[model samples]
Target: TICGLFGFELDNFERAEVQKATRRLLEHEKRFLERGLRNFLIYKDMFLKSVYRAGLPEILIYLPIIESGCSPRARSRAGAVGLWQLMPSTAYDYHLRIDYWVDERKDPVKSTEAALKYLKRLFGYYGNWELALAAYNAGPANINRAIAMGKTRDYWILRKRGVLSRETSWYIPRFYAIVRIAENPAEFDLNIENAGKKFTFQVLELEKSLSIRELCRRAGIPYSEIRFLNPELRRAITPPGRRYNLKIPAGSLAPFLSAYHGIKKEYIEDVAVYTVRSGDTIGEIAERFGTSPSLIKLINGLRGSLIYAGQELVIPVKEGGLINKVPIRNNFRNYSSLISSSIRYTIRRGDTLWDIAKRYRIEMEVLLALNGIGYNEVLMPGNEILIPVNPLLSP
Candidate 1:
């Protein structure tokens, strides 16, 4: 209400722009409106108790409409993300860590707290609720300058001055229209559950830094569900440090904590170099390395798989070398001199001997020859294999 009232102080143009934006939202985002309302209802108690305290439910409902339309894993073009749409810098200011392993902006509960803090601060800065809402939509700095230049605190006056962009000017009205529809979903053609459901969680305290894979193993929980619970963990692994709270399904906490330490941590290696050539694709390279294109993309910081001829790309590999490098063997006495060394590796899941050989830039026959593996021998996990360390191959 305060945020909306602030809109009254805007210039005629600003007010009209807000109205136009409101019309656009009412027309374009009908489904999103329903979803936002549903989520608010679902998280009603938690939203009210943890964040809003005494704020109007409509204000709480307005968040997802402005954020990600209630998409839990929504990522913006600017990289501001999650249900609350927090930017990285702002997430950090609110103590939401973004690191190799985790990004708390994607964590709904954590991000809600951060978003509320930001909203509250904005409200405090602009006493007029409409101005606060406008500031939230555009930014306080922009609104402040607009008010100063117009010599009027009216949002419509500022809008007439053309200080805010079309989208931002209308953002508040859109928010208001959405609130109107959200308050009474049945009035529209939309027919679905408006009442929110309850979500329960059990706090998981880590005794040691463990990968999500291992956590799932010990807990008898699926990785999909684990990801749902701990979206903050970016990679499958949780980084080492002080124990942080991990939310899990309501019932599994006790059993999970009991065997959490017993599951052996299997760390993946992610370092490799691949030569560019005539026909190389990110998907192909990823398949060859037994990883996903997204992982490769992330590790290499690739914009869009645009590569040039003869370019060298760094690839991720299993952490430890599977095959041990062979030591130097004696040179031939008859000829001038030739020496070689080789490495050994154990077969791992999803690994082919050919793939392994190509990874180290060695011929398939050479790999088979060095390891004394039979042509018919099936590669089994943990089977010892040898790898030649010499870059050159004998003719």
Candidate 2:
């Protein structure tokens, strides 16, 4: 066999689907292929290492090329994200966090592990890589229904009988075409000199909140460097109240640690340090910070709202400090004012995304795009979501 995928041998290059995808990649999608190929070279080692550790084939590294054009930050309209295109629900099920703080779906290493576990599970259940891969595109339930309707476990049969959706039917062949070309790039005149190089980084345990910009200034590196390594940071800052694993640029540990030690204890970004003035109140402070009094108290560890004048308080500045200065919920103004800038909204009882969209008078599609979610995506109570104040903005 000239090509083998998962456990299936493929000597049938004459198949219309596989050959057609190959030509399209070579011609119409050539530019797209070139871009994805370049990105694949950069992250090749990172993707392949996880595949290897999971005991999967090296060819599986090409899956991301098919899924997201090898971009870690790529996201589908359906809200699937990262190299593996994991949905929010699936990411949550696999212990990946997607929130106002971070979306771990964009984390290369972590998402790879979670995705590989899922693929392994699918393969194990179906006992056929083709079926598993088909299920990966269309959900398992769809694949199951396809199998039952077609009266066969074979993906090609289901695809041939139109039991599989158009997208799912093409997904496998596109994947195969990509793998065949990638397995021997030289044959296609593709040059990837550092394709085998690994993505190396030194992990720094951050105990307090720090913005990417401040960290970059301290580490003497570009903000893009740290951001490139940590795509999960939603606000470009590590959250407080937990220790975060921050991946710094490879070989920058010495300088980063040196600058980090001299920083003040309470110094953090996305927050304002205020000295309580005479006649000051928690409600006043909260309003000024675009946050709730409860959040301010919780953050400062205040049991009751008893405070003396001249006491320093850390007030989270939401709007530009960076996630959006979300006004305390009840005091929200008219939709025009509220939707003019980014704001964080906590889902209240009996609230649906559509209802919120109606309240804001924003299109449901626009609202979903702003949050990088689908119309059908779940909105749980107490979960904070970002809302775009500007009508022209898209996620």
RMSD, every candidate, angstroms = 16.8, 11.0
Q: How well does each candidate superpose onto the true structure, as a TM-score? A: 0.61, 0.71
- Candidate 2: count the clashes: 7
**Candidate 2 per-residue lDDT over residues 149-266, each given as its tens digit:** 9999988888889999999988989988888888777888865565454467999888876555666787788988787888887655576546889888889999888767765333
Q: Tens digit of lDDT per residue, candidate 1, span 260-346?
A: 767653334434456678778888877776656765565444659776656555455543342122121211111111113544466
Clashing pairs in 2: 318-324, 318-325, 319-324, 319-325, 339-389, 340-389, 341-389
Clashes of each: 37, 7
Candidate 2: TM-score?
A: 0.71
lDDT of each: 0.60, 0.73
